[model samples]
Target: MSKHQLKAVYVISVAAELAGMHPQTLRIYERRGLVSPARTQGGNRRYSDDDIELLRRISELTDEGMNLEGIRRVMQLEDENVQLRRELEQAREIALHAIREAERAGARGGGGGDLVPLKQAVAVFGQRPSIFDRD
Candidate 1:
């Protein structure tokens, strides 16, 4: 099966069961906008493995005496952090791909072999000269 098909997405009831919480609590969380699940064409909620994990975290936080408002803010911050991490990972992969492509091109004896020096490249881009340089 493809990676998309392998995703562990479940209905609200199933997710509630997995997280050991009542379905009504899940609905309450949804109503509070704590977790936004994917919706079907019929507007039924679909919970992914990530959503279940977040629910468990919310449960844990609440059990520790955090109010719903505090939990909501924490969840929002956590979600933002997760998104930033994913973006950083994608950027790293792109940079690695570019490095590999450059190496291949350089090995082919094309003009690509004449890559600009770091300082020269920075100068070309109008950046200040390297700090290590003597006046």
Candidate 2:
């Protein structure tokens, strides 16, 4: 798993302490759907580092006078923004790779893929006389 995908290990009390909030507050946030901590095999809540950061963000939004619903909406928008940014980066990377492959194919005199642009794809590839030229 990636660093961000690390399993939750911090229990509620520790997570609350790390986030500088009361344990009860953490429970409230869970009930509010603000945070979704992982559950242990025994059905216990375990918060990860990412969850701690989320708790901090919740605290910030609350401090800024945003209601729980408003904070939830803001977080949803932020999550969408992050997902779009990541997808855009992946698309850019794919485009760059395609460009590089195209360049290499051109350097090899177009001996690469089976497909080509219609504008360049004459039915007769070699020196063949057209029907117009025939009469």
Candidate 3:
């Protein structure tokens, strides 16, 4: 978590004020599963900066006439999109590292008979095996 996300410093009232909403409105949002603020040891709700930003986004979506369920779905898809992008970036980095290792091995005369290049092909297996077929 980023520093802003790690620090749940704002109380519900302060968060509501920052998000341009009433405190009760914040509670309603929580009840609707729109926002989940952090809880203190005493069970008080504490909002991080990220939470405030999310509240603002919810307010925007609501102002645009989206229902709560629609907003929740949109948010879920947005989070999934971000996670997929991160995973793709990590995969690209891993591929590049493997390519570099292969290049280094070839440079040092290590790419000999030990490593065989693979030929990728598709196999169709719809037909059943027959005793007449030779191995």
Candidate 4:
């Protein structure tokens, strides 16, 4: 989390103002499992910058004429897409490291058949583009 996100200092009213949303709308978002803010010992809601950003995203999705379920699914897929991209990048990095290590070992000892190039070693999950990314 960023510093701003870690600091859940905004009360519901302040967060609503920052996100350009109503306090009741924030409450509804929380109820629908879109945003989760922290609660104080006194049982007041405290929102982080992350929550405010999510509210803004929700607002954008709504403005685009998407239903709540469609917005939820789009957000879920976006999260999954981001995660998968991270995982794929990590895998590619690992594969590159292994290829370099094998090349070094081969240069030292004349054995090079054990390792494969990155394109051959790694498998992409899906190349299909998202509807949101379509023209």
Q: Quantify all predictions' global Cα lDDT against the true fold.
A: 0.83, 0.88, 0.88, 0.84
**Predicted structure 3: lDDT:** 0.88
Report the error of model 4 at residue 44, Å. 0.7
Pick the TM-score winner.
4
lDDT of 1 by residue, 11-127 (tens): 888999998899999999989988777876678888888888889999999999999999988878987999999999999999999889888888887674567865432343566
Q: What is the alpha-carbon lDDT for the whole of candidate 2?
A: 0.88
* Reference-based TM-score, model 2: 0.72
Q: How far is candidate 3 from the true structure (C-alpha RMSD, Å)?
A: 5.0
Candidate 4 lDDT, tens digit per residue, 42-123? 8888998788888999999999999888989999999999999999999999999988988888888857456554432333
TM-score of model 3 vs. true structure: 0.76
Better of 2 and 4 by TM-score: 4
Candidate 2 C-alpha lDDT tens digits along 1-135 = 445336788989999999999999999999999998887668888899999999999999999999999999999999999999999999999999998888888878887563465433245666663544533
Model 2 / residue 46 / CA error / Å? 2.0
For residues 67-129, what per-residue lDDT tens digits would candidate 3 score against the true structure? Answer: 999999999999999999999999999999988888888878884624575555454588654
The parts of candidate 2 lying over 4 Å away from their true place are 1-6, 111-135
For model 3, the run of ten residues with the poorest summed lDDT: 113-122
- TM-scores of all models? 0.56, 0.72, 0.76, 0.77
Off by over 4 Å in 4: 1-6, 110-135
